[model samples]
Every structure is written in structure tokens, then in C-alpha cells.
Target: MTLTIRPAVPGDEAEILRLVQALADYEREPDAVKATAESLSATLFGEPARVWAHLAELDGKAVGLALWFLTYSTWTGKPTLYLEDLFVAESARGSGAGLALFRALAEAARGLGCGRIDWAVLDWNEKAKGFYSHIGAKPTTGWEAWRLEGEALDAL
Candidate 1:
């Protein structure tokens, strides 16, 4: 199967939102997805805080997407590409759509002189871990990811 990857346009917001929800479902955290098409469109296509997205198409239908934003790396003293979410519809897996999306993100990082590309994979998702390893990506062994949520998150 042939897949094409391209930057998302304003018209693609609905499909992107669908893919994002699909990803949340796959992670068994459907409620964690608080985004609606309208909200996504506003943030992604709006000014001042635009988030970039890459879509993967197979036979002209979007089957996957990657949502990312730029971040600064104090250690490298340069920007990094942080993939906030990546999703490939179940029907489209094993057809290289995921890899195509990742390649596009990597190319974007390189073109922008990004210091690194980083993303998180759930600890229980062995398939994703294997795919990442096959692509020469390794988890930072000594570091733990932390987050603050709810009221504490709001205060900060």
C-alpha cells in the first residue's frame, strides 16, 4: 500500500479530531480526550498558538495523524519537536501509515534544525515499543515522566 504524508490544512481538522479520539480510545483513556472539532480547529488553525499536524493518507483517505509542537531543550540549547499525539486507525495499521507519519515528523525536525524528536509510549503498549525500537528509538532509561493535574496543575 502506498501512503502519502502531508501537513494538515484547516479543512482536515475534523478528520484529525477523529483520529485523535481514536488514539485516546486505543490507549483506554477515552475520557482524557477533551478536544472537539471546533476547539481543535480554533487552536490548530488560529493565530498565536498554532499547533502543527501531519496527516497520513492511503489511497487518498486520511488514516493517521501526528500532532506536534515545538519545545526548548535546555541541555541542547535548541528547539526540539515534541510529538503530542500520534494515531493510526486500526484498519490502517501494518500498511506503513504510522511509519510514514513518523518519517514526515522527522523530516520536519531536521528541516527546522531541531535538536531532537521526542514522544512517549505507554508502558503497556508493547507493539508500539517494538516499533519504536525497530526504528532505532530508545526510551530514556533513567528518567521518569511526571505530571501535575487537577487543581495543582491549574495553580501552576
Candidate 2:
């Protein structure tokens, strides 16, 4: 039952992609994912990395991915750990892999003096909502997420 959470290295490209694809499938947008290992590697391992990730291994097998980056909180005047993606394989969901991954992220935030950690969950994913609630995360009721992308983003 030993679970290990470690920073992703270059050799873990394939595992990262596999876990990301699995997450996409669970989110019901399997084909929406266009991230390649090359893109991930460049973002995570390239000089002046803009993002980072943690890989969770259970008994020597890859089972989860937690990709994140630092974000500033203007009000708090500190940084926050923004968890971009968190995915645990279906076979490992209840085995505490997800919990371990999140705990690791919290530790990363603490180490960096971050004010808090933030993430988004699809509104339809009740399972994720339950897990997040179980971890003591509250929904930000008044704030709605907005996006500027595609043609709108290009036009601006």
C-alpha cells in the first residue's frame, strides 16, 4: 500500500500522456485533448518552465497525474498553487491515489508560502464534487468562470 508522489521527469512522458487521455475519457471529451508528450515535456522540462507536474505511483505503477503552476493572489499578496489537472485512473480512484496527489500539491503550496490552492471541476462531475467536498474544499458561489478563446481571443 505504499504510494509515492514525485515530480514528473522527462522519462515519464508516455505515462503522463496515458493518464491525461484517461482523464479526458472520464470527462467525456476524449478527443478534446490535443496535448502531446512533446508539448508537455517542453512546458515542464524546458528551460524556464512555466508549469510543473507530479506523478503518483502505486506499487511501482503509474496511476495519477497532478499538473499545476503558481499563480498570484492580488488580495492575499501571495502566490497560490493552481492545480491545472488532477487525474487518477479508474482502477485507482478509491485507493487514495487522488488523495495522495492532492496532499502533495498542498505540501507544494505550503513550501512555497502560497495563500491557497485553486482548481475547477466540471459542474456535471458529481463524483469530483464529492471528493472535493470530502477534502474540505468549498465552492465559490458568487464567481463564475469566464473564458476568452478561439475567435474571440484572436480578435482581441
Candidate 3:
């Protein structure tokens, strides 16, 4: 399969959401995603462009994506590219779609002069861990991932 990766455009919102929902399913949380095409378009193509995504296509159909944004690292005093989500459809997993997405992301990071690229992987996803290892991505030790959501987020 030929994998092609490119930045998402205004018209690709629906395709992007499909990949996101597919991701939620693969992670065993089929109903966890709440994102909609309207929201995705607004966020991805808004005036400020807060976030960016690169979509991967195989045989002329959208199959995967890397959704990310820029983050400033205090210690490094430079920008870092933080990948919020990375997913390739099950049917397209072994076709180098994931690697193509990461390579596209790396190119974006390099274009933006980002110092590092980071993202989290589920602890139980051994396949994902192996893939990360194959790409030379190491998990940061001594730091626990934390988040405030739902009631706690509303409380704040």
C-alpha cells in the first residue's frame, strides 16, 4: 500500500472524526469520543489555528491521522510538538500508515523548529509500545500523567 500524509484541510473534518472514533474503539472506549466535525473544523481551521492534524491516505482514502499542537517547554525555553492523538484504522495498521503519520509530524515539528515531540501511550497497549520503541520513542520515567476532567474539571 502506498501511504501519503498531508496536512488536513477545511474539508477533511468528517474524515478526521471518523479516524478519531475508530481510535476510541481500538482503545476499548467506543463511546468515549465526543468530538464532532463542526468542532474539529473550527479548532483545526480557526483563525488562530490552535491545533493541527496530518492525515494519511491509502489508495486515495483517508486512513489515519496525527493531531497535535505546539507547547512551550519551560526548561528548554523552546517549542515542543505535543501529539494529542495518533491513530490508523485497523485495516490500514500494517501498511506503514502510523509511521508515515509520525514522519509527517516530525517534518512539521522540524519546520516549526520544535525542540522535542511528545505524546502518551496507554500502558496496556503492547503493540503501541513496540511501535514506539521501533521509532526510538522512549517513555519518560519519574513523571506520572495527570488530568482533571468531568466533575473535577467543572469544580475548578
Residues 1-156, candidate 1, lDDT per residue (tens digit)?
A: 668999998889789988998898999998888888888888888886568999999989999999999998999998999999988899999999989888999999999889999999899999999989998899988888899999999999
Model 1 spans > 4 angstroms off: none
Q: What residue runs in model 2 are displaced by over 4 Å at the alpha carbon?
A: none
lDDT value for candidate 1? 0.90
Candidate 2: tens digits of C-alpha lDDT, residues 1-156: 778999999888889999999999999999988899999889889998889999999898999999999999999999999999999988888999999999999999999999999999999999999999999999988999999999999999
TM-score per prediction, in order, is 0.94, 0.96, 0.96
RMSD to the true structure for each prediction, in A, is 1.3, 1.0, 0.9
lDDT tens string, model 3, 106-138?
888899988999999999999999999999999
Local accuracy by lDDT, each model: 0.90, 0.92, 0.92
- Model 2: how far is 132 from its true place, Å? 1.0
In lDDT terms, how accurate is model 3?
0.92
The TM-score obtained by model 3 is: 0.96
Stretches off by above 4 angstroms in model 3 are none
**Order of the predicted models by TM-score, top scorer first:** 3, 2, 1
